[model samples]
Target chain A: MATVELTFSALPAHVRTARLVATAIARRTGVEESLLDEVRLAVGEACSRAVEAHRLHCPGEPIRIELRDDLGRFEVTVTDSAPSDELEQERELLRFDDPLGQLPDTLMTGFGIAVIVGLADDVQVYPSQKGMRIRMSWPAATNGLSPV
Target chain B: MDLKLDHHSEDRLTIVEVEGEIDVYTAPRLRELLIDLVNKGNFHLLVNMEKVDFLDSTGLGVLVGGLKRVRAHDGSLELVCTQERILKIFRITGLTKVFGIYASVEEAKEAHGRDK
Candidate 1:
């Protein structure tokens, strides 16, 4: 497994940094230009969501992002330090609240996960030992699978 | 990520040229500018996203908010985007039906003018 890891402060500023690092890794590995934009946007949404989660729950923990290129497929995981159930609560909130979908313009929440789900070829959310892990994968070749 | 926002007037339309990444940190900056512009009675807004290389959900929220703000004043908020990456977000969110998106600033201006 060819892997790259980045751990950064759970700050808004670091979200862009995470995206840039992921873009650099993807480019260096010769990921297609068309897919590079998706990869970058997915990485940003994941990191930004983690940062927001940490701000509300963990407060001071750093976000951990791991990228693994397994053959022609690439996997990126963003780990948050909040409790495992915190993500469940968030998922429920997203379902009920309609953060970006139906909310009034005054509400500025809910677009992160939607964009992540839209861009990532595959998305898996699971509870880790410390908190929760959001794993997103992108295949080098086009897969007909849509975001779930 | 540096965001450069340039404002200009063309054919009585307000055009904002946005360059760089619009994410969590920088979105608020754009939001403030848009809100200020709308509040100042400068509506019929056209945001040119040609140079914006990256945009996240936060940026989308800001745009939606700007749209609503302008609509409240009976004005319009349009987007000038030629990049598929940025357009994908709008399409995924079904915002294409909500905002008028054009290929160029001139097209956006003309479309808004036609509406008036």
Candidate 2:
């Protein structure tokens, strides 16, 4: 297994870089093309949400991302260093499942988790000692859902 | 990456040609452009996304915000998108039902012309 770790300031500009790096790592795992697109978007959404959370509650701390390629599967973990209370609040806002029509104008901006969940094959969230962590993973070969 | 926006006006309908990735970093610029157009009384808008390679929730949020802005003026906002990758984002968020998505820019223009 190969692992790559990246730490960058929780800023919007850095989100693009994070997505590009994650996509590169995923590509090397020989994942399907369509699944790679999902990986790109999932990583972007995760980093964007983390950056927003850090901006609101925890500033000056860098967001950490870990990419692991186990030859058969690829995994990514995005960690945010917000305080425990702020992390809880952010998780609540992100885990929402309301339809778009039911959401208020202010809440329409909070669809990061839904995007991630729709793309990744598996997702897990946990409260770390420093803050919170979100892990997303996908198999190297997705079945017939994608074109061969 | 940054966004590329090229717009032209025809009879009150403004068509914006958007290319490149649309994410958190680039979405704010798109949002500002749409707001400026709405502020200048350009309401009926159709964004051409045939060239947009990527879009996330932040980009979708800007489109939804633009839709609300134009609707407030009794106008409409639509999109010209053919790519499955970009369309999937809209479908996943249930935005396909909210915004008018046409197969081509000409189709969108003809529909609006018929409405008038």
Candidate 3:
């Protein structure tokens, strides 16, 4: 099992760095070449979401990303330390989300969560008391498709 | 990485060539460029995404905004992209139907034949 951790200030600039690092680890972990774009897009969406949350709610907080490869399975978890009072609302949306990947209205436009759910093989979002964590996984190639 | 933007007038419309990744960090620049073009009376806009290596939801949002900006002026905003990787993002976002995506700049211009 190999794991890589990245921590950066909740700035939008760091989102690209997170995506690049995640893609590198995923490629080295035996993920298929065709799905690399998915890996990159999912990581970018998750990180961008976290950065937006932090900028709006908790300035100066740091975002954390973890990339793990185990048994030919690649997984990424992005955490944002931005507090939100709308935890229940978020939970409700995740549960009964209007058609996965369906974008929000222009005024309420936030496409990260929707896009992440669309691209990731498996996704789980946990809203903590002070922050939120999004875990997304993609199955590795030549691994007989062990669910991540 | 950062983004690069360049545009030129070709007979009837303006085509903006975009290069590099478009994310939350870089989407604002694209948005600014689009807004500037629209503000300068260059309403009919065609963005060439052939060199765009990465695009996220933020970038898509910028494109959508640009489209809206042009629509307000009765102008059109289209795209030119051949990369399947980039096109997949459009499909994922349901933007494939929203933007008249073409395989090349020539094809996109031809689509605007009525302008000629």
For residues A20-122, what per-residue lDDT tens digits would candidate 2 score against the true structure? 9998878776676779899999999989878877887777999999998765778899999865454455445642343333333234334677788888999
Docking class of 3: acceptable
Displacement of residue A86 (Cα, Å) in model 2 is 5.9
Summed over model 2, clashes come to 0
Q: What does candidate 2's lDDT look like per residue over B5-55, in tens digits?
A: 889999979999999999888988899999999999999999999999999
Tens-place lDDT digits, model 1, residues A9-30:
8789888888888987776565
How displaced is residue A83 in candidate 3, in Å?
3.1
User: What order do candidates take by lDDT, descending?
Assistant: 2, 3, 1
Provide TM-scores for the models. 0.85, 0.88, 0.87
lDDT of the candidates, in the order given: 0.79, 0.83, 0.81
DockQ of each: 0.45, 0.49, 0.38
- Best DockQ goes to which candidate? 2
Residue A58 Cα positional deviation in candidate 3, in Å, after optimal superposition: 0.9
**What are the runs in model 3 whose C-alpha is more than 4 Å off?**
A84-109, A141-148
Instruction: Give the number of the best model, judged by lDDT.
Output: 2
CAPRI-wise, candidate 1 is acceptable
